[model samples]
Target: MVLIKDVGSEKDKKLSVSEYIKLLNNSLSNLYGEVIGEISEITISAKGHVYFVLKDKITGYVLPCTIWETNYLLNGIDMEIGMEILIKGRPEFYGPFGKLSFITKNVELVGDGALKKAYEKLKEKLEKEGLFDNSRKKTLPLFPKKIAVITSNYGAVIHDFTNNLRKSGFQIKILDCRVEGSESGPELALSVRALRGEDIDLLVIIRGGGSIQSLAGFNNEALVREIANFPTPVIIGVGHHEDVTLASLVADASESTPSLTAELIGRSWEKAEQSVDNIQRKIFSHYEYSLERSSKILRLTFEKAKKSFDKILKIHDNTKQSLRHGMQKIKEKIKETQNGVSDKKIYITQQFQKSIDEVNNKCLFNIPKFILKKYTKIIKDKQDSLKTLKKLIETNNPERQLELGY
Candidate 1:
């Protein structure tokens, strides 16, 4: 539905050299195509325009070429004098110098050999600077909460990357840009710069597999250095098969496909989950073991306490029985002592009564006998005296007195 304008198609019109050249230049803009040649001479102007000689390998012919600064940067290829390359643009005649030259709109290394040479050259240079060293790589976060993705939005790379993430809560922000073609390197670099100060755990640049020329943006030195110096760890998923881009070498992590890039991030989450599960299982096992041990100790302590209590109870019973026996024996000994004391008291009383009765009888019989003997002697003396008196009285009275005096 859209119409295009052709500037130099009117060949029959009369025109001046300047006007014809301007017309020719306008026509050349419409005559866009590509040329393949080996670079023999090249120079970059102070303004960043590249002027080079493209030599025909077979014919030994050559063409002078000029690339505008912006277009030179878009391809991001560092061209060497001997390198073969494909330049896409049109032929133009300059009015001031009256010269014919190829004006390049885009540039690419022509074959795998050139690509390899470029890759090796850059690899060696960066390696010498330690950009590809493992010590320079940042360890990826275990669980990234915020992520920045740099890729073309029109492709399946974003879809695959987003679909493959396994974590529950992740803030994925996309900076859509060209991932192939002339401006891929500069645009990708711009995207990286835009994300530099962002609070992101990771910066991911993903692209599908491509030919060496198609994937040359990943090998761009500027983009590679941008990735190497990124504040966040960079994950480059920009190739397929065994191809390794310079960006991959310099990145913190690299994978072959978008799916693999996603898997790399998801694996961290999976591993973290597995670790937590293992720790949980360990804690549970230790708790069970401690509970079992504590139960065993409690049972043992109860048994020991029960045995000690039973022993004390038995000792108390023995002591109680011993005390009862001692009290009974003391009571019996007291009763026996009381009975012996009563018997001794009765015997002593009987002996004392017998002695007192005997003493009383002996005193009564002896006192009466002595009094009767004393009375009897005195009576005999009185009778003798009376008889003598009677005799004296008879003699004095007659002869009986003399006989009685003798």
Candidate 2:
């Protein structure tokens, strides 16, 4: 005989195995779980419980399941031995058989192509949102202050981008992510958000060389949306010569390989440097012109000794000082033309350098002004020749000269 020490509190009561399973199903249904899985079998039992097995591709997980519905799946739909289905189902465990089950209610047929389906759906959504519009495209900055790279850590993609960028003298911030498999979307989105606070002028979303399936995470809708809304411009470097994904379409620029993207950016920087070289030359030449012009004006004042000579010299001095100050302003303006710009400034002054040469030639103090006097005489001789020709044509025609001389 057993003596009962009655612990009568309801809190002491333990749940039965069946009750625990029922509670688990309730919790799972509350969570609203769904998966895209491949079905291995479908058959009708005499008891009318439909049994099947669902397995994942990469993981190869097989779950034996039963659906308790009279007509949930249509009869004569002919589900074969190997068919993939998107199962909207709740987990169940039968106490009698001691077997696990997924009692699916709403099943959609998508064949055995998870990647293809995901690609099509993502492409459709992105296209409809106008993420791929040409109007939204931004020209890349030639000399970006900093660039953000998002890719898997310690991979060929990240390695190539960082090394090349450092060699090219660009600052880089890398946002590491899982570039493949199931957790890819969340990781890609995290990388995109990381760029928001990094103060990057541009972003590079990159992946190593791999199959189309390996890069599927970059094609995820959430990541693509984050990219489309990213404040900084993005460059997609997926590294495939063929088979561009939807992410490429939505990005600001796309390159086939990581190395190619780096090369393109480096070329743009070179062009900006070339422009700076050109502007520097022009600015120095401009300053030289100003100095020459000022010296010429100063020397001109020393020449004439006549009435109001000092007064006129004072006027010329003031004018020369004012023009010198004006030249300084122009020189400063020309120096600022090196900043990166879409279109080159088209208003260059013609003969600007030649004018400086003329000023420099005219300002000589040690050399005699004999060359100037000689050039003046030559101009007078040309004028006299023109007058002689006109007067001779007016009176002494060749025929009239023949009669007079004869």
Candidate 3:
């Protein structure tokens, strides 16, 4: 709606750039003076302002562009090299430079599809210089005792964050602020600056679900730069499934929603308990196998002793036949003596059984019961670990598992 007035430089009405700008402002009394298009060509000059072209129909025609230092100050765009943009401005003339141009008041970035070429050109320049390396990313703390949240206090984001973390026994301090649209950039930068407190563990930047335009505040250069340079790792929960901003890339971890971010923090604690339980299962399984093997070896030794007693009885029978018939009575007495020896063999067998019983009493019964106490303690420990894993899996609530997908 910006009116391009006919301020032709003729006769006594000479004008300076500042004076001309004032006249232009007066002539256009806030009729929403400019409507920036969705796509345009952007450029820069040595005089610290942006120059661009706004072409709608791809015809053999071009529109002049100009954005002064004040406009640039109010709306700070880092102006990536060869970036495509959409611009709106009021037409004006520079008397000294004798150049006619549009004084840009608003800008839009349309950097994909027909807009994609210039976007790729600028992205390549920054990427080749190593601006997007995974190694540059920071690690999130596992057990952050003190959490700092940056989000709107009156909304669902703060409610979701506080409820989840507080229920899980975390101490948090929230730095409440606006987080969307035209005015969000400066406020977010200010909120991040206030987190210079030393007691902070992890910082969470969050917002509830919002439109793409509403989410633009987070994509601003100042906000993104602040996130990249933050001391602690930042957790971004911008809450729009489709909008992944520059801030998302620079953050330590980005969550789709505030509730999901809180759950992630909760999962870390559960995983620690799961680790301890896994180790317990391994140790318990080893001891159980050892006890079973020892019992098998004891049973095999008892069977070997019974076989040796039978072989001794067969040798006794063979020796009696070797005796001559000359001394029949003497042979009879020797047979009786052998019978006595056989009776004594029965006594010896009884003694062997007594000794076996004693050994069994001391080893298999008394000592095994003592060792069983240790094994039983191990069993209890393993059981505790199993219970922990169950709790962890249940709390996470995997959707596939609920569908019985194993």
Go through the candidates in order and give each one's C-alpha lDDT.
0.81, 0.66, 0.66
Candidate 2 C-alpha lDDT tens digits along 1-406: 2222337753444567777677666776764557777777777778766788888877989877666544232211223456676666677677688776777654444532655665666577668878899898777886786888787786577667656653556777777777774346556776687678777788888876565556655656667777788888889888542457667888899888888777766777777777999999999999899889988776665554443687788999999999999868755553443221112211212253355356457754444589656655765685577467546643544444545764
- State, as a TM-score between 0 and 1, how close model 3 is to the true structure: 0.46
Q: What would the TM-scores of all predictions be?
A: 0.62, 0.47, 0.46
Tell me how far the alpha carbon of residue 130 in candidate 2 is from the true structure, in angstroms, after superposition. Answer: 1.9
lDDT of 2 at 284: 91
Clashes of 3: 1
**TM-score of candidate 1 to 2 decimals:** 0.62
User: What would you estimate as the lDDT of candidate 3?
Assistant: 0.66
Q: What does each candidate score in C-alpha RMSD?
A: 21.3, 33.7, 34.8
Residue 92 in model 3: lDDT: 65
Worst 10 residues of 1 by lDDT: 393-402
lDDT per residue, candidate 3, 116-138, as tens digits? 34234434554575545678878
Ranking by lDDT: 1, 2, 3
- Least well predicted 10-residue stretch by lDDT in candidate 3: 111-120
Candidate 2 stretches with Cα past 4 Å from truth are 1-121, 138-142, 166-170, 181-183, 266-268, 284-406
Q: Which stretches of candidate 1 lie over 4 Å from their true place?
A: 1-43, 51-66, 79-105, 110-144, 154-156, 163-169, 181-183, 263-294, 333-406
Candidates 2 and 3 compared by TM-score, better number: 2
Superposition error at 246 for model 2 (Å): 1.1
